[model samples]
Target chain A: MKKNITPYLFAAPAFLVLGYFSILPMLQTAYYSTLEYSFFGPHRFIGAANYVRLFTDPHFWATLLNSLLFLSVTPVLMVVSLTLALSVRNLLRGARIVRLMLFLPVVTPVVIAGIVWRWIFTEETGLLNHLLSLASVGPVRWLTEFPTNLVSAMLVTVWRGMGYYMMLFLAGLALVPREVEEAGILDGATPLQQVWHVLLPLLRPTLLFVAVVSSSAAVKVFTEQYILIPGAPLDNKALVSFLYRHAFERFDFGYGSAAGMVLFGMTLLFSYTQVRLMDREQSS
Target chain B: MRKALSRIVIITASAAAVIPFLWLAATSVKGAEELFVYPPTFIPRTFQWENYTGVWNAIPFGLYLVNSLTVALLSVVFNLLLSSLAGFALARYRFRYRGLLFGAVLFSMMVPKEMLVIPLFTSVLRLHLADSLLGVVLPFAVEGMGIFLMRQAFLALPRDVEEAAVMDGAAPLRLWWSVMLPMVRPSLAALAIFTFIGSWGDFLWPMVVLKSQEHYTVQVGLSMMLGTFVDNYRYVAAGSLLALLPVALLFILMQRHFERGLLSGSGK
Candidate 1:
């Protein structure tokens, strides 16, 4: 029997790239977290000092809270996206165009969307304020203030994300057999009840997938905040934004890596659940 | 009543989703004086068509576009080449440690790039690739999502086709190149589009790795320019819209493949 070396040869380049780029860098992050290191400064051993500073810092907690606040959008996104999907499914006309319009934001680069939204959210002469004035509401400092800015950023995520998630739900809804809905109708279920019992139950797997994906994305939220708010202070930063600021902006590699490790742990948990969900999907 | 209500809901949602893009298009062509009006007009009285051309000169947008194109194209080429080879090996051959290797690929897929940025930056720096185009492209040249998609594509093919090729004395490489790859053309298209979008729209890594204006990709360059022109943002609007044009065009022309790529990419 010939021992075929073809497979190994074929697989070598990919493994090398992944090893150096993905696997090696992850392990290196863990090491960097332990050292008081920066690109320009000499590496000094700092046993848990960075972690101590991070834990003690109120700003760190603020960023963590900001991340949790970001996660709050996941539920809103699910409801809005699912509603859009279900509504479009029932539409008798222009469903394809409607879906296209909804999905446009998903493909548009976040920076571009951020540019437009920033203009809209400008305080005095901004479009949003002008619209508010029609209802006699004074200009709300959307991007300039703290919590409003965060909420405004969340609005962009929801607007940009719902379309993609809606597509996921649309795919899921397509898989559901027609008979199930018919049976719900025979049982005299209201339109709302039909969704509650028939559609949502079968779409649970997709709901779980969306939940994990959206939450993981929320945890790593960067572009929206970075684009909309620009250089937000420590208190207003998302966890990843905090890590970016420290690592790249401040050049505090040690502190930044420690912050990054925390974010890594969080996203790893979400990714683990996602992988499990996907494996279940594949096997089923 | 129900149908009307649903139509209203969808229309409102679509408008919310798309109006920003329309506003951007309108704002991009507006002259400096036309901006910041109290009742912001939806359409420019006279379209500043030069704004589109001006974006290329206001910054080194041509340089950024080239940088972005090089990174995206190189990424697609390498990702397709390496991932398909690896995927073919995983799907077609039974080899030692195949499961472990496949598992490694899946594991790599799950770990977000942002989480690894600190070390990724340092590693690229150590290898003397930082602030170079290769530095931006190399780390993401072959992604887990590509390999996984290709592997799934290959696995879906029937075994008899490959068996007949093997019986005819075709070399494994030749068999893969001629027989297997052509059958997976749709998957390849899907993977290529995904890779192009990901690489072209990538911001954080490019921003971190690239230091000079000469190396900045469109997103990074436009971001810097936006900061520079905060009060007067017409140029930035034009610049961002230009950056979005290729992708918007891609999405329009290849909607089917884009949707396919996106649904498959739901895992990541």
Candidate 2:
């Protein structure tokens, strides 16, 4: 190839767009986090006052806790999705139907999914309550209740996630060598032992991918909490929802920016650790 | 016996995964009286197609649909053209800061969207792009995954093609457009499907930016309708169905490319 500025010119558009929208906003967000921004008063530098408020605000702590609690769905999603992948691997029946049905939610708009779920949890006319009544159970408050609301939201997230991750695991499972599985049989390992010792080690990359993606999604979750539990009840609000209410609803830019920074830091830390773990897996 | 057990597990799991969508379909057509009935009919006795039209009449989903299509199509066009170009630059050429630029792209993927919402909104407001579809589209028009996928696609191609083109006096743009892009058809298709679906489903940014009801995307429209239709379960269900239908069908139609997007996105 001849030496020229062509490569630079080719790459210019994407870099410029990302620089304006992604890189610059991040810096502005960092700066906003330190200010006492007000709608009426002149804005002034507060030097971490917003973060300080975050430490003292129990609501902030609760939202952070709720966000972390949402991550409890990660392992469950991985195990269930992977198990489904493994189970369907040798199936001679219903494979196409099963695959289509499971993966459907991955493409559904989150807001739409959340809205449908909201009706499913309706106290008087909900599908769940009606089904529970078959066993003579009273209508259980799902979204209005505390831990149950959290659980319901997590269940939705997990349900929506399983098939997407199942595909990943299936992709990984396909890569495992047939000779390796046969060697397990030659070594007299049971099928369960073969899965535990051989298949899982080979599936590590997909499993890590599922874990990282699921956790990151769990933390950034907004539409579900926004639609399912409108107004973002303090007890059940995720971190992003809290940021929305403060920043957009309250017009409290500084506090929202502070919360946003905390959320961003946690996401970065979590993703960095995940990348490092995957790298370790590769190097080993 | 083991076969039977696995069948049972697979069936049960698929049902769990699919029942909500089934319920969504059912509720979309159920009459007002049947929605609250005991042991709710798994299938509606009366499939009230009117519910669809009712919600259609109630909300400006027509406008919302147009807005969504505009943003998603533009995002797709920009992503396909720009990401492939960027990918070619990184994969086929020796450029300054190429490694750094690629690293930046990878790093952008890790930064959660939650972190950037406030600042992006502030940026949008500052630029007077607030309340327009442009703000909604601006944040995501050039996807990181698109560039990454296109780069991977380009890297897999033989190097000789570009050299041959250059030897024939094909300019950089011509080499990328006429020679190189046609080779990565699969990736371009995958990126198009992925970006279109993502842009269509996007809620948070659009909800924040678009103050006017007319500018609301499908997701934003449905969310706002969700608040107003608290008592109108049928209408809400219809709205939800409307929000989901287009992209859901698109996914069904283009399942192959969408699946490829998923496969490449979950990098090994």
Candidate 3:
């Protein structure tokens, strides 16, 4: 009895804090998502009206499509980083320095990254446009345009993220036994064949983990859009930014919560499906 | 031949990875005229070192720095002590609902942070703690990643040491402090490094909860440097360089621990 009491006492502080801050708030979100409330006054029970409104809204659908578009870049980043990792895995010297350089941006704040990239994407005096001019191309309004804004955001995401994913892939590569490679090489297998047939199979678990994390990150991407391109620019649109303007700027907490809940649901569904699919692949 | 090709690939990839950061630093020094040159100046003709001073004067960056440091440091101390205790319990003791509690902790990791922000903001406001450093630090003090890392570290330890301490009439608290804690130094260091990095880099929650400019974190303060499309890009860049200093230093000083922390925290 004393022994059990001691353990609980030890764990109580953290659990209490986390419970009050994390669990309780989550419960409140679930509760409030069911109600119609605002900062100004009297609240009313609305059952699933918020969710109903969310599904019916075209903007919600647009944001959902935007999120999907944002997510498409993760695979491109994954392939690029994996290839980079594979290319650099064998270096006996300067590899650690190379790895460190790649991972530096991951450690830097996303806000800073967003701001810096915004400067680079600026229309007239931006670094990207300035460089492009040297190639005889006209200046492009990267952030001021719709699809271009999304593309610019994706570029920043890829640049900031690829190194971190490369490190993870490097870790995965480290775990691959050398004898498998040696055997493949002895059998006159090409390097690509060896990687395809031997290394990739062993890397399945790591691939799945990266896929889920990166995908979830892609969906919740707000800082980049918010900092780089604040508004739709008379033609462009950002789903999360639009949601932010509605919630905080306009004080539409109920609507914002509804949007957040939808985003959360989509993220969970996507990540869960990916995890399960990967699990099935591993077992098979 | 393969090795030569690998070298070329690595060089090209590394160049692509690092060029943006280099350009940022270079552009920070370039004059307004040089910035918009037809052919971009990779090197600035005149270094504008005053951009740092200008940026510092433009905002209450000093206050923001203090606010961010205090909140982050306090949060780190709280997390290290609380998480180590919880992690020790989870690792060493058998209690009713032990699995349930551990499972709950793991399950919390899956819930996207965006889902919680609305409720969290409401709760903080209800408690009348909004727009304060306490509001910022309190919620973050109990971290899932820290506990997870510490728990894994504790599990990897030898049981014989604790059993011997028990035979020596050492209380659990004494054993934890004097024996177990010392053994998990690497894990503790890892947690500290990661926690500090996360706290320092965090922007979204601070943006939501902190209303007063006095309580703004460095990230938020930096954002204030850009107002209504009338930004001084050089100053903002200089401020960003300043803001990045601590995190970069922390990473370099504790690179090993940072790597371990990231690996364990991410379950990679």
Best by TM-score: 1
The number of the candidate with the highest lDDT is 1
State which candidate, 1 or 3, has the greater lDDT: 1
Task: Name every residue pair that clashes in candidate 1.
Answer: none
lDDT of each: 0.87, 0.83, 0.79
- lDDT string for model 3 (B110-221, tens) is 5667767777787789889899989888887886656766777788798798999999999989999999999999888888877888899888788889998888998888
TM-score of 1: 0.97
Query: Which one wins on DockQ?
Result: 1
- What lDDT does candidate 2 reach at residue A117? 79
Q: List the residue pairs that clash in candidate 2.
A: none
Error of 2 at A127 (Å): 1.5
Candidate 2: where is the Cα deviation over 4 Å?
A1-3, A39-41, A136-138, A273-284
lDDT of 1 by residue, A143-246 (tens): 87899999999999999899999999988998899999999999999999999988999998899899988999998989888988886676886899889888
Ranking of predictions according to DockQ: 1, 2, 3
Model 3 per-residue lDDT tens digits across residues A113-228? 88888878878877789878889886887988778888988888888888888878888888888898999999999988988998889998778778888888898887877778
Candidate 1 docking classification: medium
Clashes per candidate (backbone, < 3 Å) = 0, 0, 0
